[model samples]
Target: MDLVDIDDLSVTDLGAVLDRAAELKAGSGPEAGTSAGQPLDGQTLAMIFEKPSTRTRVSFETGMTQLGGHAIFLGPDDIHLGHGEPIRDTARAVSRYADFIMARVFDHTDVEGLAEYATVPVVNGLTDDAHPCQTLADLLTVREKFGFDSHVAWVGDGNNVCQSFVLGAAMVGLDVTVATPEGYGIDDAVYERAAELGDPPERTTDPEAAVADADVVYTDVWVSMGQEDEREEKLRAFEGFQVTTELLGDRPLMHCLPAHRGEEVTDEALESDNAIVWDQAENRMHAQNGLLVWLAERS
Candidate 1:
């Protein structure tokens, strides 16, 4: 099965993933570490990307390597899909050689098309619509910090990261409040799905109000990968939405890295005593390793 969204997995499955992540985090001994040497000795993963990345590429590639598997990095120039080859055809061909597929692309439809044709499990690294893996890591970090009942307050663009945060938090019974500019709210479809998963999230235009009682205040870059042209406009729109020291109050701060300092967050917030930004970054590897183990066991 493909992991396109958190909602695609049940609450029970989400819990299982997190529980295993915690166990793995606590250290499972030499055998578990050695799983990387023979975990997927004969397996291979095809990682396709149309956009540039730092964490996603490194985390997945390293995770697969440590798991005793091999990963083929397929850049845009190397892939025939960009040269007019059909996504279905590419997916079929790659599936024949790889045990699983992980794609970070500009279009969400491309990931969907690949999944439609591939026989192996497909993981969505990132797209214009969602960043499920990041959300998974964020969830794991929150579990570490404030335990399972921790709440998350998002203070920035209601972009893909925010959408996934809401869905993932709801599935795990965490309260999530999204505060964005009036015109920059999350997609209604994503909100509705979060509600269907369990509890509907609280929405607000005031970032401070959203983070007032939050255990974790999360923020992402004001503009995403494909929205570079709107950087100035987003900066203006998200002016008051930044996670500053005053805004954080007693809440711990979380920023997904490649952070645009002074834009979505201030230097003070990034350097604050309550900041877990680096831990969040490192947890990407641990969380993904657990996810690989979970998926492998289930498969």
Candidate 2:
């Protein structure tokens, strides 16, 4: 079993995951990983990352600790895969000891390759093609701030985060509108898939149009990890898409964090009451806690 994307979980499963997260956050569930109630007691989680991360690393490690499990962080230098070992071979070998594998890699195919070989559950911490975990937290936070039937807007690059948001919106029957530049918009294939989720999404070049009447305004860095060489070009392309406080106009806002400060969004917008970034960021840990418990129980 693997969580490569939100689509991996049906609406029922996604709802269950969120419900469990609420229980965990409310302290309504039994102590996880403890002898009396720990569902993952003595379980070990293997976390592999080729890219640098602050939240992803901390959240997963802390979630495992809180649940009475151990999380071993594996950096590029810590594993043979860093030294040219075949991904499948490494995946198979690691599965022998760890109960689950969570990988944050530059390439989506690498995560997929790992999932194909690992005997245990695999989680997509992140990838170039999708960031499902982050979107899960985003959805959860939006639900917390405002009930369903609210409109959300994405006002920057239609990257991995945007893709995941679209899919999540479709799954939960939430409405989302995205505004991005021509070359930097959502991939056609991804948009096509989203169209099937429920209501077709609106992807446009006008930032203000999307921001207007939106309950939640979200944005991400124009330049993502592994795209450093294209930073100058990206900045130029995304000049009109910055999510300013004025654009939000009292609407709550979200960013996955590690924000560019002035690129994708202005500092005013990020610090204003409209911003729920800290809560959104914190929910990553709680949501993943629920997801981990859910996956562990299945195994």
Candidate 3:
């Protein structure tokens, strides 16, 4: 089994993962702290990360450890994919030693490659096209702040995070409105799938209109990893897209941080009482622990 994108999960399955995450967050287990669960006892997780990270690395490693398992971090320098090794070989090699695989990579195909051959489960840590884990945590955070049905407005680039957010929101029945720059657009297939699920995201170019009545207003860096060369151009295109309080209209704020602070969102909005990013950040561990345990059980 693999979780390459939010679409990999059915509505019920997504609910199960979130429910378990809620339980993990509540510390309902016998032990204390984030590392309380024993669900992955004696298991090993191979974490192959091509992209750099702060939250993804910490949350997964800490979550796996807390779940009674150990995680081995393999960065670009540590992996052969950077040295011309086929991703298939890496997948086969790691699957032999590790009980499961979690990869955060630059290419979506690389994640698909691992899932194609790995005998055990493969979890997507992040990819150029999708980010299932982060969306899971985002949904969990929103579920806590408001109910699952609360309206969410995605107020920036229609990047990978936006794509995955659409799918995750549809699964949990949240109405989403996406307002992005002219050239940027969410994947049509993602939107169509979400539409099939009954809450197709409304697409627009007006950021103000998008978040006008939203319960949660979200944004991401205008330029993500692998898009560094286009920084100046993206910055110009995203000039008026910043998530300011006036545009957000009293709604709670969300950013999957390491935010560009002054660019995509105002500092005041990020630090304001309505900002729930810290809680959103903390839920990454709980959601990931639930995901690891859920996948490990079926595998």
Candidate 4:
């Protein structure tokens, strides 16, 4: 099965992955790629990247290596999809060589196409529509800190990351409140899906109101990778939404990093004692390790 979105796995499966990640973090897992730990011992992963990345690339590669699997990085220049090779053709070819395929691309449909054609399981490392991997790590981090009962307030663009968080949080039984500019609300399809999972996030344009009763406050960059042209506009729209020390009070902060400090979040808030961003970042590897192990077992 491919992990192209948050709902691809049932609630039980998601819980299993999170539980395994917690166990791995506590040092209960077997040795890397040895004995019982090496579930993907002879497997290979082919990663296709149409956009640049740091955490996504490093985390996946390191996670695969630690799992006793090899990962091949194919950057934009290395891939021929832009040079006229069809996505289906690339998917078919890669499936022959790799045990799994992971693609970080601009278009969500591109990843969908890869999954449609590839025989091996396909994972969406990132896309314009969703980021299940990051959501998985965020869930793990939240579970470690506040469990599933805490209320999470999201203050920023209702972008792909936010959409994924909304859906995942709903499935895991967390209350979510999203505060974004009027014109920058969460996607309709994603919100509807989130409602299906559980309670949909309470929406608002007032960031402060959203965080009033929040146990954890989260934010992301005002402008994403492909939205460079909209930077100035986005900045203007998200002006009053920054997660400042005053805004957070004693509530912990969460941010998917490569943060545009002073924009969506303040340095004071990020460096504060209540911030759990680092733990969230580190959990990327652990959560993904659980996902890989689970996928291996199922396959």
A best-first ranking of the candidates according to their lDDT comes to 4, 3, 2, 1
- The Cα error of candidate 4 at residue 276, in Å, is 0.9
Alpha-carbon shift of residue 190 in model 4 (angstroms)? 1.4
lDDT of 3: 0.88
lDDT, candidates in the order shown: 0.83, 0.87, 0.88, 0.89
Query: Per-residue alpha-carbon lDDT of model 2 for 1-299, expressed as tens digits?
Result: 68998888988999999988767766633544323246678999999988879999999998888788999999988975535789999899999999999999988988899999999999999999999899789888988888668888899898999999899888888888889898878898888887777775788899999978788888899999999999999988888788887787888888998999988989998989878899899899889988989998777
Comparing 2 and 3 on lDDT, the stronger one: 3
In terms of lDDT, model 2 sits at 0.87
**Global Cα lDDT for candidate 1:** 0.83
Q: What would the TM-scores of all predictions be?
A: 0.94, 0.95, 0.96, 0.95
User: Looking at model 4, which ten-residue stretch has the lowest summed lDDT?
Assistant: 28-37
Writing each residue's lDDT as its tens digit, candidate 4 over 72-157 gives 99998899663588899999999999999989999999999999999998999999999999999999999988899999999999
Candidate 4 lDDT score at position 187: 89
Clashing pairs in 1: 36-66, 36-68
Candidate 4 local distance difference test against the native: 0.89
Where in model 2 is the C-alpha error above 4 Å? 28-37, 80-83
- The TM-score of predicted model 3 comes to 0.96
State how far residue 142 of model 3 sits from its true place (Å).
Answer: 1.2
Index of the highest-lDDT prediction: 4
Of candidates 4 and 1, the better by TM-score: 4
